[model samples]
Target: MRIHKRDKARRRMLALLLAGVLAVTGASVLTVAAFAGQRQPPAQPAATRMGTVACGDVGSLLDQVPAAAQPAVDRDLADLDVQVADAYRSLMAPGAGGGEQRVMDALVAKRTTTLRNLKASAGPDAGLPGDLTGLASCGIRRDLVVDASARDYAPDAQAGSSGSSGPSGPAALSKGSGNRGSGLGRGFVDIRTVSPNVAKPARTGSATGTFTSQCGRNENRHLNPDNVIVAPGVSNGAHHMHDYVGNLITDAFSANNRLARAGTTCSNGDQSAYYWPVLRLLNGVTEKDAKAPGGGQDSNVGRILQPADVQITYNSAAGNKVQPMTRFLRIITGDAKALTNGPANAHASWSCTGFENRQLADKYPICPNGSRVVRTLKFPDCWDGKNIDSANHRTHTAFSQANGSCPKNFRAIPQLVERVAYDVPTGVRFAVDSFPEQLHNPVTDHGDFINVMNRNLLDQMVSCINEGRRCG
Candidate 1:
């Protein structure tokens, strides 16, 4: 706590050097303290975050690759993801300041090799540039991760209805409780402060039927870190734990044939896979997977919460009668790296059980005692009608237009709507598991699923939608 004359002189000089640099959460202050020879925590966090490693997203650059080349390309893509995660880990270590350039340089070399292999896998017909120069290099991308507010959770008394049990009297968020290390406090906002922002679009099509699937919650404890759609046969591809329902035997090694043979949690015998990153209550509790790959090892900690209710439904489109989703069609609804990748593909929607009309895309909602946190993901329903999947895992499926109509050349399919609600404890702060660099930002939340319905069930779904009847 004492300052010497020589130290004061050095601080004055350093302060001049960082004249314009500013941090709201004490990162810059710590850098000045480093001159005092005191051990300090790393500043590679969202508060005073250094940044994230980013390469040009290669998947979007691809038009289409040969069907035979998919497996190798998927593996190489998964490898690139791991490389960036490793680089972030290094950057988070103490005394990693001047080492940023070295770490990024090494990451670029690794990505270059992987991009080369990926291009070769695509073969001559895939139409990839020979050098892949711009796509191969990676650098630190400046991401804005400042906390919007540190205000306490004080719900308005009138915010709760007569029948509701939350936030009216003594039920309030615990004071001074947080998990700042895992990015919790800053990501949450009191739901009472938000206004209604949701509006239902008008529909005019004759096909008014809706099909609901009774897929049970993850009562089976089926969890893993693999992503079968994007990173098949690659372990730890997601770098986080996922709550899975539907398919029984899904993993990174699961092929279409293997998935087809697996049992399901769906009551109708649907063998499809539906999964998303698990949400966690950041209350400093040790979980079973604390030392596991997708848990603490990947910078995702705290107690995982099981959904109190999970609803999966499919609705008809406004354009025409919905067609059957091609068996084994793969779809990813949100961007897992949205924090660094930008909001173009980000689709995570957060709300409270009763305050669902005020959906939040970037901040987590602080629900009252009786209320629970909710995550709703609406999957794309327009299909290209040719491939079961695409090189980018997105080109084959697309969202409907604002009027709920499919785009030109795209066929209308039953839109999948998933709503999962979590009973987060009173006063507890929470966040969904995300990539190490993503820092559990709500924007990085996403979901993945595949269609493995049998022919009879597919026909039933189409018939129900066309007939304007609600059937599960």
Candidate 2:
């Protein structure tokens, strides 16, 4: 009977994890007693009212916890609410905008304090830390501040609407044969300006290759079930959905051995997987499920309308002597702190397909008669020459220099660039889906990759980079 009860508790915890609530594993052992006296609650009723609820007004958020554990979790969450609210008030002050750096620092400190207190408050048997920490990382809090500060915040509606002319890129050319030769707008973020256009480096013993676009064979490769973005052990914890292209099959459950056997869309047979959150066009038909798919989990704005094709590109760093990346290697580019991380931390660029010249900050590009919309993602090239993964998901790799050279003790690898083009027709505007707390800021857009190639396939990619041969 005791064993059966234990099994029941384990199943319950797993269900919660899948539902995007309980994120930690090894939690069932702690939940049995807490849940033994409590009756399982009924499924949540469909929401009758739909509107953005401030983090403080999330009354239903705590209803999912086991009755026995609710008091402790609620107490800590309430305390955290107060701290976050106070910090938001301070940062939103009219003149306080200039002190963003200071605001972020203060919020992080406060988050640490809240985490510590929550940990202390959660009794050993409560199993609350992972869930609490997952939903309230300093990064998450920063997004909240950004959203709270914005006036008339509406991500879903914004995502589906059409865009206005921005400062960067070409004067908006539509897609057609005649649109050729038009360049992107000046001062709008363009890799053609920053990255070298050389086919190969002049340095001795160096080579270069450019693999053209490969149509997306799969969008499931990097749908990380054990994403570090949320609590550890939480399947599909990222809350946001991602579109992956390259490795044929990958998910939170994928393993090196499995990926080694899997085929790739890259002509070189490189099975390295890359992905980022999918952008959604909010065309009235989609519901505004802020924390979509599952409430109190993703908290993102908008619904996803799949794109026709996702383009994948693999190539060497523009001007660097890049070494082959080791199998299973992983790293994070862009600012983990996101929008709060500042200008130097930004690595994302956006422009219209033909009008790639004009760039706008935080707004989607409006294309002209013959153009499409495009998002360009550039990965870091510098590797630590060791350690496949890091605790923070970064630190194992660094960015290359402006001249396309690796930093000391780091080797350059093929720079992964992805161009996702949308087929939205004229008069329709779309925005990248973001956390509701981000207030539709483009600065928070980022991508993630994991090298899952086996030894033989990985070796082949190395040869392509080193020998200056373009494959596929």
Q: Which candidate tops lDDT?
A: 1
Flag clash pairs in model 1: 233-252
lDDT of 2 by residue, 1-472 (tens): 0000113443454333323322212311111111113322221111211111122112212212333443444455545544544454454445554444354355545655665665554444333335443334332121122223223233222221112122332222111222123321111232232222113334444567555545463544333323332122244444446666667676654666776788777655667666676665544445344433321133333455455556665666654455667877765554322332223334665666655554433335546666666776777777777766432244456777757677677787877777667765554434554443333445556677777655765566567766777766
Q: What TM-score quantifies how close candidate 1 is to the native fold?
A: 0.81
Q: What TM-score fits each model?
A: 0.81, 0.57
User: Which parts of model 1 have CA positions greater than 4 angstroms off?
Assistant: 1-49, 124-128, 146-184, 317-319
Candidate 2: which stretches are off by over 4 Å?
1-114, 117-206, 212-232, 253-258, 261-269, 287-291, 294-303, 357-361
lDDT of 1: 0.70
lDDT of 2 at 118: 52
The total number of steric clashes, by the backbone 3 Å criterion, in model 2 comes to 24
CA error at residue 388 for candidate 1, angstroms: 0.5
| CA lDDT scores, all candidates in order | 0.70, 0.46
lDDT of 1 at 92: 63
